[model samples]
Target: MCRGLDSLPITCLERAKELRALFGSFLQKSDHNLKKSEKLKLSDVKELLQWKESFDHLLSSQNGLCLFRAFLVSEFSEENIAFYLACEDYRATKASKLAPKAEKIYKEFIDSDAPREVNLDYATKAVTKENMEQPSQSCFDEAQAKIYILMEKDCYPRFLKSSMYLELTRKTRTG
Candidate 1:
């Protein structure tokens, strides 16, 4: 079973609480005096409502992604999103830098002893390790896809039902 916020170390739990408060304050801001760019675009109810349409919609919005990342942290599953973002960044790396970048990603998120190692099937881990030998842009594609699916199918739904999400939507509606 996945560990929840209750299982997090006190420091982690405190950080999660801080993030939640930060996010809540962002949502509660009513000041219109700020410049257009200074205000979070997600303050718009329409934009926040769009998050319910699809996972891609939520991820596409910078604010939405930030909130979702915070939610993942609270769940102690932030590594999934971290790995996904790292792979996305890795794919854009210059060819000359691919090997070193790939090595860094593997060591950080794929190796058995990695500090933030992501859950993966034995076969997937072996395939990813093999792909590391060549260090192509596609080296992490399979593993990234697996993590993406896991998040979309598992985490995303729970996120939609989370109190933080519900409260934000409700506040947007009633505020």
Candidate 2:
């Protein structure tokens, strides 16, 4: 009985050490991610603080884009990010790959029955479908610009008002 009692403390000490190591590792990863996220440029911060600045200007910065992308994710509009990224990728497509890639982008985001279709209007969708017949670098120009405007006018303001944005701003100010 005395031996059992003596070993109990040793077992607890070992468990405590294991738990501490796990917690330390978690903190380290968390800190790393936070640092990565905190790489916002000072000019981006200035633009974000300027209420009258165009949301397009805010998104021109990598950090601003990251923050806005995170905000869109939180609002269950990750599709916006997908569409935006797809357009960006489309712009870089080579002439040889243009047709297939354009079709894929349309089927994924512009198709009426697409699983991840964005909120494009009927006219723009029709125009995008027409553009697919002759895919060019400008094929998705109209649709991408509309989506950009939508995020700017709608999502950007809400993002600024979100508690997450508020907390991030507060941290930026203090840190």
Candidate 3:
């Protein structure tokens, strides 16, 4: 039997397969990859520094979100970011999924025994649990806003002072 010209030896085929896998994983156009390819503009850094209202804009950007998450991680407050994101995603969930999703979120982040509990006040936590009796899109609103404000007032300042954020500013200015 004659093999097609496009066919290769088993060793060559194995090498090609390995290379394909490597490129597939390494070069995929993910948020991290996009940030790596396109550095933050100097104006972006300026807005982040000068505009207090622009924290929402910063969180909306992939690189900014990643940088803020890194800051949270360093401060051991990553759970706050995780809970805030979970709430954001929960807001868009389908009506039919509201109950179970709310339950899961409450158990994960609001419950006293949660593995990643957020620092909510007793009243807010109790109200959230009561809301779980009839889960809805607004069930987590209060808790979420508290977390958002906490980050805006507390974490945001610390993040700006972080060396990672400082390095980013330096790169945007010089490079």
Q: Over all chains combined, what TM-score does candidate 3 have?
A: 0.71
Candidate 3 wrong stretches, greater than 4 Å = 1-53
lDDT of 3 by residue, 1-175 (tens): 1122122234544543443343334334343455643334334545444423567876877556655665576677878888898999999999999999998999888998887788899999989999999988999999999999999989988887777566545444443
- Order the candidate numbers by TM-score, best to worst: 1, 3, 2
Misplaced by over 4 Å in model 2 are 1-52, 172-175
- On TM-score, who's better, 1 or 3? 1
TM per candidate: 0.77, 0.68, 0.71
Which residue pairs clash within candidate 2?
Answer: none
What tens digits encode model 2's per-residue C-alpha lDDT throughout 80-170? Answer: 7668878999899899999999989898788977767789999999898899999999999999999988887789889888865565455
Give per-residue CA lDDT, model 1, range 1-175, as digits (tens). Answer: 3345443346645654664565466657665654576375455556668889998998887667767877897788988888898999999999999999999999988999987889899999999999999999999999999999999999999999999889878776554
- Minimum summed lDDT over a 10-residue window in model 3 is located at 1-10
lDDT of 2: 0.68
